[model samples]
Target: MQCSFRQLKEKSLSTEVTQMQWNPKMDLLALANTQGEVWLHRLNWQRVWTLSPPTGTTEGQGVTGLAWRPDGQVLGVGYQNGQVVLCDVEKAEVLHTSTLSHPVSCMTWQEAEDKHRVTSAPVHVDQSSSPVSSQATPQDTAADFLPRLTPLPKGYSATDKANSEEEIVEDNKRLSSQTRLNILVVGDEAGSIYLLAYGLFSMGQLAPEEHPQAKGGRLLSVTLSSDLQCLSAVVQHQASADTSQPEHTICLTTYNTSLLATRSQELATLAMKYGQVATILGYMENTLRSMSEAWEDILLEMDNKLAKFAETIDNKDPDWQVSDEFLQLLMWGKASPELQSFLLNTLTEKGLKKLGLSIDNSYSNIEKLVLNHLQRAGQALLFHLSELKGLSLWYDKYGMLGLNTQAVQEAWSCAGSFMLKTNELLQ
Candidate 1:
């Protein structure tokens, strides 16, 4: 049977579009223009959001590629400056960012079909050909271990805290794992292809050496086969030998990616593991930053109450040595002369109590945030990345992922150390 085509609504654009892609899951369209601007529009041509180039973007570093996450919730915008920003579709909020060493030229988002493969993450450290463990594969959002991360109270965002609630981006809207295996493949001018899972995980990279012809050539496009069996790219360059006509040389190359086929299932499963870790790491970072801000606020407020005392100590010795003024008041229930002046010479008793209560409450909030949100996120990251490191044990099976065991180990240790140091600080 022959398929018939119908003409959809035709609306002309006001600018020269460099690249455009339609969201598979929605009627929205994503477009990039020569001015390095990105636009999201509905089927009726109503604009949803527009993303301008990041500040300090150098001239000529316009957008080079655009791709929508398979779920259409995020858009990966690649630039000529080797930067890729994953943005939320609803508000164009920059959810995450990554950079490559070379200029980004093309990108493709691919989703893997099940092919009767089991759906679960590879969790064990032992040698196995399959997801050999009983662990749940939301990467343990279903497992007995790795506690789930709770949203931070107040969702403290340093960048958007000053904005109104309606304008602030939601923390829950950031990138996370999908049920199916989805990979965002990016290619750059230096003949390299980056395989990223969930727009966050660095699954692997095909280096310039893999395609010598693309070393100095302009990469047109790149893609991974649906079966995960082949990697392909198109490149074009000037043919110096035929200079009279300004001849151009175009090359179409496909390399047999053995690992993609042999370990396709493992790759899909590891994606979940990496994605869970990435999401938790972002949460931990936000929690840490919020804690820092909370401490700074307390310090600033205390300065108003104790600035003179602090200055007196600074003048007495280079190293600040606290006088017995506060100690005497706390222990003897009687204030020193200076302490009395700081407490307003007699009784601003109510004001003093309120300030003390405010500080105490602030500290309690920060402590609870850390003990609840931050610690859970850090432990989850450590647990999942450790599983990733274990996959490194069978390098022959997971070698293409380029998982640096040493780096993962260091991260695992750092997460553990951070938890310990934070506990020490709290205690």
Candidate 2:
């Protein structure tokens, strides 16, 4: 089909749209609005599903990006506060939600080739007639690679004997089979892209082989040079519009990891065996830390601004004026207990009442607001806390906690306490 772009709606209810994605089958479209809202529309532009923010999101956090899984079974929406919400497309139910430090700017999926092939340990077939011939036919080349098949044992059943012959012939044909294409590429905002292959298994695990040497022979080659897949990562340089033409041009950056660049296919194979799980765990943990730090930074910045405002207001000349920026900063987060007391001390009973900043009388109101904002912070925190809890549960259930005992235990302890505290405070 020809490529076409159509506008389903002239104006989106939310002013800012940060990301958009179409399903793999191109039958559905998803839009992330800056108002912490996601809308799923059918291909012909019919509104279908609308996902709302979990209640109690802070003022600034908003929807930032969206991605669809390869099979179009799931939709993942990212938020400015570094949260990810995953939805099941068919049921329209939210399945998983996560938070990262930096915002999730992008997501992509990678699929890899099935490199496992049936093999036969070839035995030199004697060509007594015209053995000196130089040129080789296609069948001759195939025969050279084919394994010397052994006849069925006397006790073998008819079905087993018949299947063994068929499998041997299939192996012989595959020895000289043409090359096939099966690979998927995925890229991320962390300046990295990965290639992955699926369905890789050992031939010994598949149909049986007939050669006498098959006992020690590996049905599939483990050496990546001739066997596994390859992967590559290329960086790109972003240039200003003034220095470049209006036409779209991508400047490829020099690769820092030749291991992935030169042997990406092999890397993909190894990734499935043991490395990918570690990489994914690292990605999840690193992202969660980054999101936590971002919230911490925001709170710290607000605290610093409030401190500077209080100092200036106290030391400045009686006629000096306070800036709106200072007041705005002061209005954010759980008002520091110390700052609340300071505001109460600096203002008169009437002035404090007017500003609604009296610590003694505002205790009830302050607690209410604190609970609200804490709930907001908790919404993000809980996302990570639950993920940690889930990981811990998996580790305990599967008995895989031994690999990273210290880290996993620490995570369980900290997150468990955090979840308890948050629930307590919220209540």
- Poorly placed runs, candidate 2 (over 4 Å): 1-16, 116-402, 405-427
The local lDDT score (0 to 100) that residue 200 gets in candidate 2 is 20
Using all chains and alpha carbons, the TM-scores for the candidates as numbered come to 0.79, 0.33
User: Model 1: clashing residue pairs?
Assistant: none
Measured by TM-score, the strongest candidate is 1
lDDT by residue (tens digit), candidate 1, 1-427: 2558777788888888998899989999999998889989998899999999877866745889999887888899999889988998877888778889988989998876555143446553344423322233323333577555655556432322433344311234353335566678999888788998767778788787877878778788998787667888998777777467557778899988756666665776666665566667777788888888887666666655665566644355555433345545667899756666667853378877876876786687688777877777767767777777777666776655666788888988988898898788688
Q: Write the per-residue lDDT of candidate 2 for residues 1-427, one digit (tens) a residue.
A: 3558664566445457766888986589888776777888886678888888766767546765566655566676656565666676765776445554444444444332333221111112234523212221112222233233322222211223432544331221111221221222323333322222321211111111222222222221111122223322233334456886533333322223233233332222222322222322333344334435444444444444345445634444665333333345457644544456655565447754544432322333233323433333333333333333343344432124222445546754664575477567446
- Which candidate wins on lDDT? 1
Worst 10 residues of 1 by lDDT: 129-138
Model 2 TM-score relative to the real fold: 0.33
